[model samples]
Target chain A: AQSVTQPDIHITVSEGASLELRCNYSYGATPYLFWYVQSPGQGLQLLLKYFSGDTLVQGIKGFEAEFKRSQSSFNLRKPSVHWSDAAEYFCAVGHFNKFYFGSGTKLNVKP
Target chain B: DTAVSQTPKYLVTQMGNDKSIKCEQNLGHDTMYWYKQDSKKFLKIMFSYNNKELIINETVPNRFSPKSPDKAHLNLHINSLELGDSAVYFCASSQRTSGSIGEQFFGPGTRLTVL
Candidate 1:
């Protein structure tokens, strides 16, 4: 079965530090990969997505993700973490019209 | 303007009661979906409608029924709601085509509490 995995359940990062969230997926073909963020009392927002061409895709809020086919990974990265960046992040893989989401990772930023 | 919107931001109801949550999208997307976020915060897709046609239905119970009145509206109705049904339900929309795939736009979720 196709699934997405976010190994870390919770992560804490100091303000202004670099941040990386890992995601791995299992699928037969090259899949449409995406990263979504959900803040407190808010809906999920699309951060970035990878379709066909470039491995590295830049998204809103200064977030980026790279899709590595070899490892079946699409990891999200940010250069400097902001206090407002503390939220829940979910990685999803899209096949046809359905999306398989990973158990989200919660980020806590220390001021 | 909100791209996707769901009515009743918060709902508190008793068990064995029937309730419905309405969702609408103004993004002109053809596909609309309903997802359930459990206490563990794991989001699982429940149902999806494409152009008023049921396309994807997960292993959800028969008590859960979805209605699509039009291309822009999708409603979820739950029968005999159980305590386990207390969770946040989200509605999302996307534009799917042969040439390009669109990112889903989510609505401010409706937090349902079955007491």
Candidate 2:
């Protein structure tokens, strides 16, 4: 069974600090990787995606994710955290016509 | 213009009632999907329709039926809605081509509250 796991259920970072959210997936082959952010009472917005080529992918709102095949991990990172960045982050793996999403990681930005 | 849109942004209904959530995408994608987000904010894929054809159906209750009238529209109907069904439902669309299903465009979710 292919599945996605986000070990960190919640993370807190101070404003202007670096942030990293971990994600791991179990798949037979390299799969499409994605990162999405959802704010309170709002729809999810795609942050970045990794299909092929360039292992490093940049996404909207100053977010970037790197796909490491050996580790079977796609971790999301940001240089500096903003108060506005406080939200739920989800890591997803896409295969064929379906997608498997991780439970989610909630980020709380402190002042 | 919204690429993907869902009707009834907020729905408050009683248990055992049947309701439908409509979805439409103008991005010209051939694949559409239905996702459910629980109160814990866990997102799960429910169904996927490509060009009005069912392609993927996850482990969901039979009470949850999805209808795709056309490539651009996918609707989800729930029968005997239970309190456990209260959650946010999202509609999404993507293009599947050459073994690459790109990123999905999501609509503003419909928050369903069954009492």
Top candidate on TM-score is: 1
- For each candidate, give its TM-score against the true structure: 0.98, 0.97
DockQ of each: 0.66, 0.78
Position B2, candidate 1: lDDT: 89
Binned by DockQ into CAPRI classes (incorrect, acceptable, medium, high), candidate 2 is medium
Model 1, A1-111: lDDT tens digits are: 899999999999999999999999999988999999999888999999988899999999999999999999999999999999999999999888889999999999999
**Native A-B contacts reproduced, model 2:** 0.72
What are the per-residue Cα lDDT tens digits for candidate 2 across B13-33? 999999999999999999999
**Worst 10 contiguous positions by lDDT, candidate 1 chain B:** B97-106
Q: Report lDDT (CA) for all predictions.
A: 0.95, 0.94
Clashes of each: 0, 0
